[model samples]
Target: MSTLSLRGIVRQFGPLRVIHGIDLDIAQGEFVVFVGPSGCGKSTLLRIIAGLDQPNGGQITIDGRDVTGTRAAERGLAMVFQSYALYPHMTVRQNLAFGLENQRMAKEEVARRVAEAARMLQIEHLLARKPGQLSGGQRQRVAIGRTVTREPGIFLFDEPLSNLDAELRVQMRVELTALHKRLQATMIYVTHDQTEAMTMADRIVVLRAGRIEQQGSPLELYNRPANKFVAGFIGSPRMNFLDGQAVGGRSVAFEGLPNLDIPAARETTEGEAVTLGVRPEHLAFTDGAGLPGTVDIVEQMGGESYIYVTLANEARLTVRRPGQTQLHAGEPVRVAIDGAAHLFGRGDDEHAITPRRLP
Candidate 1:
């Protein structure tokens, strides 16, 4: 296990700056995941950590040592890329032993390491097969096994499951988490998929533009997002935002919906413009008064249903309802808030009022 710290990390391409002054500390044996949209510099940041790409500025340290100038080979880290970069001509056994042999390790030690890695990865039976003969998941396992044979201080994964099918991706997620538990090595993973980050990481780092939006446990970010972007980004159905004005100390007045008093932990201004963020799972069809909208569409997805409702002001709202629903298109629906909600100010000014913690 290894600890890492990054200070004032900066990256630029000509005049366009991507990463700006990122300072982060990663503890020993923790699995940290970097998540963001495309072109958000997640991969670039991972590369900088791996010493594959030199940063335009800042420092990288590992285990109390200044390793900013260290080469990738000496960084004590192994990285698995998205493409499962396997040598097609070589069998799995040769591929796993290649790096150890290049270091001139004894043939006995290399063989032992390869055997152990193959056993750990459950690829012992497939050791004689070449990359071209393996399935996508099997090839990925071989790629990971190649890294495991080296036994570096930290393991880095760059969207290593993006190529697999949905079922395979889920299966690999469980396998990778189990692998992390067994190895207990420090890991830094970069992925565009938030689901992957949520499930596999001990902590998730959310990036936007070039800066760190927030970093915390998955439930921490989901339950108490630091800002509007994060509140909207981390969840599956994406929190719905309604433009409204703060009124009556803790209440917000929207045009179509009734004046809703928020359970705010902080005081709200009397007439400040605010956006009310509510998750689809937090809403439900109400028998009494609620947000009046017309059901635009209903997606019956076996165990659950997704209801798309168009509010009176033409804003689209999605409500995730558990189990089957008889509701169809063009039906009138009144949705009420039943769970968590957030409030934000205009122009992404953090949370206008932080919500109260639920019992």
Candidate 2:
């Protein structure tokens, strides 16, 4: 395991600067994930770390040693890519042994490492199977096994499960988590999927337009986003946003509705243009405690249902409820917002706002 640090990292393609100056400190054995929309320079940043691409300006240090000008081969890192780059003709064991062979490792040592990796991955029975004979999940596992045999100081995964089906992705996520526990190596994962970042990362680095938008734990970004973008990006079914003006400290005058008091103090003064944010699960159905809305759609998912309701102001809202609950489209309902609502100033900076309680 090793510590990885980047200071003033910058990447430019022609006149277009893709990655702006970024700084990060990754502790040894920490599992950090970089997540953002496509074209956000996440992949570019990872490539810079692996020495696959040199940064325009920055210092990269691994284990306290500067490796900014180092070659990828000399970086002492194992990378598992999205496309399982396993040789189709080679069996699982041969594929795992190939890297060690290139370094002129003893045949016995190579075999030992391959055997150990196979056992760890529970693919011992597939040793003789070629890539063509394995399923997508199996191929991905072989790719990971190849990395395991290298036993590098760090492991880098670039959306390794994006090619798999939903079920396989979930299964592979569990396996990857277990693998991390067993190896305890520093890992940096890159993905656009928020769920993957939320579930797997010790800390998530949310990027936008080649810049770091936010960096924190999943819950932190979800519950207290730094801006409207972070708040909307980190959650499933996303938080609802409504245009409003700050009525008082932590309270906003929601359009067509009474003054909604937020639970926290507003950083800005009254009458500032702001957007109110409330998560779907925070909404409760009440007789008259909530803003009135008519259901537009309801999606049932075994254990829970997502009710899509359009409010009087024409803003769409989704409310999550137990699966047994019945809410139909075209039905008028009052959905109450909790004291946990978030507010974002017009400048897009996240502002602290207090949520008001109902009578």
Candidate 3:
């Protein structure tokens, strides 16, 4: 079993504390992603797990064995870095065999592992190529193959695709997902890209400042965010938020927006300040009704379009529409928000008031 666990993990650099007490349990063979904005300690936490960095206070365990004080190599974890970290002078074959060779692995066993990893990553044809001769994607595959040759208990990837272009990033994301399935290895990946976290992870741990804000399956985080920050951060184009106050016990009133009835599951007292969140896809154009606005900008993608609308109160919102849109900048439009709105209490500790629901 390759299960991993962390307890009371904490890290500090002089007077600055970057990672606060964090506890997590990762099941064997699960592909987990740590996601957050830069400086949020996601990478720090992953480093701690890999034993590259020590936590000021905490315990790390793998398969129920304590490894907090073990050296990085002793912990039996393999890490793929963001920079690929390949030797400039070595060919792909040499790079993959380098680590195993250091351990004095049997020649036959090393050859077998190298051949299997090369085939698995589809890099057999490029084995003789040097890093300078390979493209970004090929070098990345070689980096990953280096880790595979070791067959470590846990695989740690620190933003492995950050160097690739948009199209290659998407392609690598799919390939990584397939690799996880084929190897069935316990994997932990760290990245600031939500799209990567959403598309590749079996579960995502969202971090902020020095603590974990939330952790769950991608759909769970998207459909039922735990707070205002999470609601704003998880989606593409992001969820739109508006200032409002509860009124008549079951309704909310916003400037320039019609009073909206709250769902019974989301109980709110009258006169309480609240923030209302609606995703762009949830806002639909309606004629002769709903909130009044003028299109500020219209962004057209191949399959969908996003209309940026400015309301009377000067509040801007993005409305997503299917396929091509006939809307244009400065055009008058009215948008009706779907009932699947999210409500959160006021201030920094804006806890969610919206009932958790599946999409």
TM-score of each: 0.96, 0.95, 0.96
Instruction: Evaluate model 1: give its lDDT.
Output: 0.90
lDDT by candidate, in order shown = 0.90, 0.87, 0.90
- In candidate 2 the C-alpha lDDT for residue 222 amounts to 81
By lDDT, highest first, what's the ranking?
A: 3, 1, 2
RMSD in angstroms between candidate 3 and the native structure over all alpha carbons: 1.6
* lDDT string, candidate 3, 1-359, tens digits: 29999999999999999999999999999999999999999999999999999999989999999999899999888999999999999999999999999899999999999999999999999999899999999999999999999999999999999999999999999999998998999999999999999999999999999798989999999888888887887889899998889997777788867876666224787788998888899889998567888999999996999999998779989999889999989998888876468889897878789653323
Q: Candidate 2, residues 109-131: lDDT per residue as tens digits?
A: 99999999999998999999999
Show model 3 residue runs off by greater than 4 Å: 264-266, 356-359
Question: Candidate 1's residue-wise lDDT over 1-359, tens digit each?
Answer: 89999999999999999999899999999999999999889999999999999889999999989889789989888989899899889999999999898899999999999999999989999999999999999999999999999998889999999999999999999999999999999999999898998999999999988889999999998988888888888989888888888887867888866787776624677788888888899989998978888999999998999999998778889999999999999999888888987888776556536766433
lDDT of 1 at 357: 45
Measured on C-alpha atoms, candidate 2 has an lDDT of 0.87
RMSD of 2: 2.0
